[model samples]
Structure formats: structure tokens, C-alpha cells
Target: MQTQKSFEATTQGILYLVPTPIGNLEDMTFRAIRLLKEADRIAAEDTRNTQKLLNHFEIQTSQISFHEHNSKERTPFLVEKLLSGETIAQVSDAGMPSISDPGVDLVKAAIEAGITVVPLPGANAALPALIASGISPQPFYFHGFLPRKKKDLNAELETLNKRQETIIFYESPHRLKALLDQIEKVMGPERKIVLARELTKRYEEFIRGTISEVSEWAQNEQIRGEFCVILEGNANPVSENETAEWQNWTIKEHVEQVMDTEEMSSKQAIKEVSQRRSQPKRDIYAAYHEI
Candidate 1:
């Protein structure tokens, strides 16, 4: 009896989102390799770049371009193949796709079409930078790439300066020095910063110091390769003595004191002092306006 295929055999084709290595080829996971090899077709952000990687692993899967420039036009085509039961794998040139790369749109399209999407765990730059930054990693933000325009980038940095969590960002080699200089001017020269260069590759280097110091060092070298920047958040703006004094004062007086010592706005001052003194932020705000 020619009997039996199971429920698994009837499953629709899956869209596997695989992450390629950022730098070292050895960092590529076995599971990623298996998925790529087993897939019916591989959609890459850059066929040439992905081809180099496939060549290294001796993977013979056919590749097609599926990047930002053509993703809108190509997603539907790939989806049609999935509907026909062809397993497809997607990869960016480096790191995770759809993350500062092309992959998000396609993934969204696949999901809307009711196709299964699978993400393969692999290498990334942000986590490594945050963990090695020697800063509190529990509350951290990934800011991706800085804006190329000076004014916009500075404005972006200004907002980050107020955060109490570690901030991570990616920078290009040629623009690394410029970014460091801007970070110093906007976030204060003494703000702690870590520069991770050419991560996981030969000549990988980590430079850790005050923003000004790193900026100076970066100027003396020919910057190369990708960078992951980690900036330490603003220190607690309130002092222990200030906290104790605020605890004894009326909310209005506490807000005034916070404003006088720190150059913070009234609202921000109230929030800061309230947290320091274990008081409600709203109470401080209400008293600041005599409500």
C-alpha cells in the first residue's frame, strides 16, 4: 500500500529570515547554514555579497536580489513562490536583515499573506557593544545609524543625552570621527563612550574613554570598517544632600530647589526631585504651579 504522508507534509512553505555574520565567517551558525542549504531559493539584500558568503560555505542554492531598492517590487513574487510550496530563505549582506537593512518589508508582506515566517538566531552588533560597554545593559536603546546631516544628528544626540539607559548606534568608517566630535559637543565632553570597530573580524578594536578622548584618538587614525558606539547615559542629576533637603520641603520649594541647582526645566526638575525624594512626581508638579 502506497500509504502515508502526514500532516507535516501538507504544511505551507516557510519564509526563513536568516542572519549572516557581521564580520567573521566562522560566526555563521550551523542552523543558518542548514536552513540556507535546504531552502528552495535564497533572497538576498545583495546577491553579490551573499554569493561570496555562499561560496565560502560551499552552499549551492540559487540567489536573487531582494533589497530596499527592489523589495516592494519583489516581495509579491517571492510570496507567490511560497504559496506554491517553495521554502525561501532571506539574508542580508551582514548582520540581521530588516535591522538597518532590507528584510522588514518582505517579512511583513509574508505575514500578511499568511505565510509562516521563521527567524534564525545569529550574530548582531548592538548586543555585543552594550554588554561589553561596562554600562548598565538592562535599560539600553539601539539607535541604529546616526543621521548624516549635522543638525538632525545633533538633535538626535540631544534627545539621547537625557536618557538614563545606555545608547547604542552604528557608524560608518569614514564618518566615525565626525560622529564622535558631534557626540562630544552635544552630550558633554566627559560623557563616557565606547567604540567597537571591525567587530568579530581581524583587527577588531575597542576604544573606551570620555567622548573627547575617543574623538581625539579617532582623529589620529585612518578609520576603517563598521563601528558600534555605546554611550553611557547622563549621571543622576540630583545629589544625596539635595534629595534629603527636598524630602523636608513643600513640593513647591522642592521644585524650586531642583531648578536652582540644576538647569532643568520646571517639569523635569519636579520629576527629578520626586524620584530622588521618594515623592510623587505629580505632587511636585502640582506644588510647582500652586495647584
Candidate 2:
């Protein structure tokens, strides 16, 4: 149990987790600017990209590369600098560091070494997309990126489909259509979803509709920009008692029933059965196939 008084004076240097503007330069806060100007050094995910931000703000602080590929090599070095009382500010390419970025390893090292980690609140992509989604905001689950593989993505979506809170996800433009297709397959076409793109930028856009509608829209429109997908929560989540109806059934029987009742293909039925039983997909497959 470690208590951190972020502003308290200490002999050791503090590590500031600064957030950069996601898209708009105006989103950069005064405090973030000041901290960047005052810090002894800035540890950036991409020095070239961060150099642009530094140039825009006229911040002359020197930067050291500390990204995902080189984190293992740089974390110890950064920790040493902090121990030597050299203040450091860590920034990602955009938005908050460590949220789908490369700052967690260094933050963990700083904390373990008894160094203070100060996080400055500023721009982030998730919240802005959530509030504008017209979905309930109180309870939200932010799952940054989903699995890439079809089976893995399907299984993951099946679990998320049980959540009572709004779900948020980040997806690249190239994969958005495929993702929406999977969402429609797993969560049903009627489920509401919003796709927010180029957030805070002049070309920012929001495509809101049922999963089926969005899927149809994607078919005709040329997809562009990163997306923050906000999905409405399961209005009628399955409870333990709800699972009781099929809990006692054999895996094969469960898959057969789901395929027959929902009119889903065997593969989709197997994925759903695995999720419901909390069993491995391969195991369910073997049982269903009598392999």
C-alpha cells in the first residue's frame, strides 16, 4: 500500500504521465503545456511524432524514445533518471499515455522504485466518444481493441454481449466492417451501435444506428479514419437462473439446440455454447463432433 502525494516535495524526481491531444491541437491543455516545458526530459512513444507536437507548442524539452518495442531497455534507464532527481514527462503519440499506448511498463517501474507518478487529466478518446454515443454513460466497459482472429473475436464478443454496461472499443478503419459484421452476428442486428471517427477533428463524424443499419452503411460507404465504437448494453442480460435452463444440457445438445432455435450455423452455435458453458472452444468442438 503506497500513498502518493503528487505535489509533495521530494528528493527523488516525479514521473508525469501527460496526455496529448488526440486530434485537435487546441485540445492540448495549459497545464500539459507547462509540464512539458518544465520537465527535465520527455519520454515519448514516437519521438518523430512527438517532435511535431513539441514544435507546435514551441516546447524545447529534449525527448528519449520509450515505446512498446524498446520499453524493456528504456524503463530501467528512465527509472534511474527519476531516482537521480531528474523530472520526466511521458507522452504517447496522442491522447493519454498507457491507454492502448506504451507507458504502463515505465509507470510500474516508477511506482516500484518509490518514485511518484503524477497523471495529468486531459484529452482521451473513450470518454468523448461515450458521452456523444447517446448510450447510458454511468456504467461503461472500455475494451480498447478486440481479438483479431474470427474465432477469438467471436468468443470475446459473446462474453461482452452479457454486459449490462455500455461497451466501448477501438478499431482501425480497415477492420471496421468486419468487426461490425461480427457484432451483428454475435449480438444480433437490432443492437444499437455508434461509430465515432476523427474525433475532435474538423472531419469528425458519427454513424449511429442498429448494427444491421451500420453494416449496410459500411457496405456502400468507403470506410476511413480510426473508430471508437460504442455499443448499447444487453438490456436483458442472462442471469444464473437464466443459464439454469441449459446448464445441465450436454455440450453437444446445447450446440444443437442453439443452432436449431436461433437458426445459427454450427460454427456460430459452437461459439455461443462455449461462451455459455465457460468452456474451451476446442473442447466444445470435440464434444459436439464426438472427436
Candidate 3:
């Protein structure tokens, strides 16, 4: 009887941040299972999705539907349970919660409310794609997902193109080809890119080559699954012939000349010159005294 009391007291409720498998079910960690089973309540992004996983593991812990649509209303109630000493676990449909998902807001609220929040270590696609991408993982930037608008996407890619460390972007299967084409147009066709698709799954594939090559390949194949595009940093700048007629002009004039010759818009011309010169857009604009 004393031991049972001790166990109950020790089980004071806490919020557990559980990580689900991104692709393969085998990737789920044992600790995650133990915590999920032990928790008094589980908040799942999608009850149906979590039910499938729970059924496989035979975890019968009570679960509540918590997602973007209901997060605003649900978080307060979950926090109340934690405060009342009811241990709760939160899991996304896949991967870690709040990472390109809805779990982050809940975690933030829990922290602000002085509740204990625990994160379980497990599968993540970003790190794997970066490490296997054959690019410097350190000092790299992970742009969760690109903007859908063409101009917005190009602008974002332009900024990343100037970064010294590798850049990783999450892309959907349907948009992979279009994204690659934009990368080629805004950054350059010769830029190196690594496409990691269906990671850890049976059909996992890594297509590494110049942006143009990968773009062409994706165009011809039946693309499926989520994609992580890892791009190599810009190459070193090259010195152009200073005496050339186009070399000595102001940055704006040079940009205008390229726009005229290539029949590209001002934005496209700016992007091209910046990539070729291995300089940031702001610096290029400053050099031409446009800014």
C-alpha cells in the first residue's frame, strides 16, 4: 500500500513532448513508447493518425484531439490538467511536434505557465538530410518551407543563395519540380543541390547533382513523398575584366545592361549578377550606388 502511494505521488503530471516517426514506424524510440503508455493523457495532432500508431504499439492511454484548428481552445485545458498533477503527452502526426507543426504553441504556453515540459529525442528529417547532403551542416540554415508565391519564393531563395553555409528547404512532392525550376532560374542552373526523398522508407532516394540536372530528372520521373532540398553554398567570387565596357559601370547600369541583353526583369537580373559575383543583393545594389 505504501509503495502504491509512492508511485502515485511520483507520477505528478508533466507535459511530455513526444516525437513520432517521420516515415518508418521502426524509427520510434522505446522511451517514447514507455512515456506515451505511462502518461495520464495524450494530445494528438490527429486522433485518427495517432490511433493507427497507438493500435500498432498496443498503447491504450486515453487520447484527446489537439491540432491547429483547436489548439487555441485546447491548450488552456491541457495546461490545467498538468497543473492538477495529470501527466500528459503530446505527439504530432509525424516527427517532433511544433516543428513545422502545431505543438510549439502549446509548449510555449506550458513554459510560460511554469509547467514542466519534457522533449523526447527521436527522428527528424532536417538533420538527416543535412548530414547526408555532402554539405557543411554546421552554420547552416533550415528554411522550414518556401513561400508559395513565385516572387516571394524567389526573394527568399535569393537571400539564401548568398549565405555561406548550406541551406535546407522542405518541399512537398507536388512542388518539387517547380521549386527546382525556380532555384535554377533565380540562383543558377550550375549550383549544386541534393534532393533527399522518402527518407528512411523503402523507396528512399538521394539525387545529387547540379540544380539543372536534378530538375530535368524530376521532370521525367514520377516524384512522390516529401522532399528536403539541400543546396551547396555559393562559389567564390571571380574577378571580371576591369577594362571591359560593362565592368566599370555602376551596379545599376550593369544590372540594366544585363536586363536589356538577357531580356530578364530587373529582379531576375539582380539575382543573376548577385549569384555570378558571389555577393549579397544589398552589397551589389550598394556597389552600383542604387541603395
Candidate 4:
């Protein structure tokens, strides 16, 4: 039972989760610059990469290396600094710290030590790519990266295909083609998908089409930049096996089953049942009401 009053005064120093621009340097927020300047120390994923950002903004604050390779060794040291009333600002090479980055471990340690952790929202890649993907913006599942192994990847895709919400995934340029091919195999070639790359940069591009079209495009074109893949949700999620069982049931019984299983209204269930059974809506409605 922990409550965080962000603005309240506390004896312990605060931990700030800062977000850096993904590509465009101008996307850096004024508050982020100020925090970097004011924080006692900056914990960066890569000090060299982050140094360029600091130099561009003319921020001379010192930075300590804090990335996946060293997070285990650094988390305790950062927590100790926070315990000693030294403000710590954590930043990744780009975008938000913990999203596909290693800032989460430090955050957990800070929280356990009773230090206030404040997150500053500035820039991120997932939301930007999602809104522009021409897919349903609401009810989206942000999957940062998929499993690399073939068996694990197939298993993951099988589960992800069942979701009704639009799915988002991050992929490197080198593996993009193989991933699309695998998706085509599991989800079929007709599924609509969008691929956005070089986000926020000058060469930012989006390829929107069916999985087959996109996969074909990837085969010949020079692939570059990290990709944000937006896959359309399953529109007709009811499996063929479910439809097979519908043949044995009465129209009214089918409507009731769809209503209960899909959690849809009677009107919606009737419409769905009519489409699945290849019958008129009026017929389904009449059968449902015993009219």
C-alpha cells in the first residue's frame, strides 16, 4: 500500500524517469532539459550517446552509465545515491527509459527504498507510429519486441492473433522480412498491416497493405531503420470449428450462443448470426423472437 504524492516534500531525493527524443532533437522538452540540468546526476544507458544530447542542449551535468549490461551492478549504487538525498535522472539512448530499455530495474529498487519516482513524458515511438498506422487507435496492445527464436515466435503469434485489439510490435531492419513472412504463414496473407520506419527522422516512411504486399515489398527494397509493425485485429474471430457446431443448432439457439460468447447485444448477435449462417437478418430476428 504505497501512495506517491509527486509534488510533496520528502527527506529522500527523487528519481526522475526522463524521456529523450527518438530521432528529432527538437522534440526535447523544456522541462526535460531543466531536469537534466538540475538533477544531481544523470544515469544514461550509454554515456557517449547521451553526451551528444547533453552537448547539443549545452547541459554540462555529469552522467553515469546505466544500461542492460550494467543495470544489475548500478541499481544499488543509484538507490544509495537517492537514499543520500541525491537526485537521480535516468534516461535511455532514445525514447522513454523503460519501454524496451533497462530503466525498470532501477525504478523498482528506488520504489522499494521509499524514494519518489517521477516520470516526465516527452517523446516515444510506439504512440507516434500507432496513431499514424491507419488502424484502430483505441484498444491497442503495445508489444515492444517479439521472440527471436522460430518456435517461440510462432507460439507468440498464435496467441497474439486471437486478440481483438490492434497489435503493435517493434522489429529491427535486418529481421523485418523474415518476421513478415512468418506472420503471413500464421495469420494469412490477407491480413492488413502497416510498417513504419525511421520514425521522426527525415526518411520516415510507412508501408501499408496486406501482409503479402508488404512482404513482397520488403523482399526487393533496401530495408533500413527500426520498424514499428501495426497489425489489424481479427475481424471474424469465431473459428471454423465454432461455425461447424452452429449447423447443428437452431437459429435461435445460435443467436443465444453468439450473444453469450461474444458479449454482444441481441441485435448485434442477430446481425452476426445472420452473416455467419448466410441468412437474412429478418429471418434470424423472427426466429429469435419466435415471431
The alpha-carbon lDDT assigned to residue 237 of candidate 2 equals: 68
lDDT tens per residue, model 4, 1-291: 999999999988999999999999999999999999999999999999999999999998999999999999999999999999999899999999999998999999998989999999989888999999999988999998999999999999878877789999999999999999888777766667999999999999999998789999999998999999999886676576976888899999999998999899999988777655645567889999999
Clashing residue pairs in candidate 3 are 13-87, 98-104, 251-288
Q: Rate the local accuracy (lDDT) of all candidates.
A: 0.82, 0.91, 0.82, 0.90
Candidate 3 backbone overlaps, count: 3
Instruction: Report how far off residue 49 is in candidate 1 (Å).
Output: 1.4
- Encode model 2's per-residue lDDT on 81-126: one tens digit a residue: 9999999999999999999999999999999999999999999999
lDDT of 1 by residue, 1-291 (tens): 223222235457888889999999999999999989999999998899999999999999999899989988999999999888999999998989888999898888878877778787889998887888787787888889888999999899767766788888998899998898877766656567899888888888899987778889999988888899998876664445754665678777777876888888887887665555534456667778888
Between prediction 2 and prediction 4, the one with superior lDDT is 2
Pairs in steric clash, model 2: none
Q: In model 4, what lDDT does residue 283 have?
A: 82
Better of 2 and 3 by lDDT: 2
**In order, how many clashes per candidate?**
0, 0, 3, 0
Question: Which candidate do you rate higher for lDDT, 3 or 4?
Answer: 4
- Across 1-291, the per-residue lDDT of candidate 3 in tens digits comes to 111221233434678899999889999999999999999999999999999999999999999999999999999999888888899999999998888888988888877776777788898889999999887788888778999999999898777766777888899999988998888876766667999989989988899987778989999999888998899876433234532665677678878877898898877777667667544565676765555
- Candidate 1 clashes: the total is 0
TM-score of each: 0.78, 0.84, 0.79, 0.83
Q: Local error of candidate 1 at 223, Å?
A: 1.5
The candidate maximizing lDDT is 2
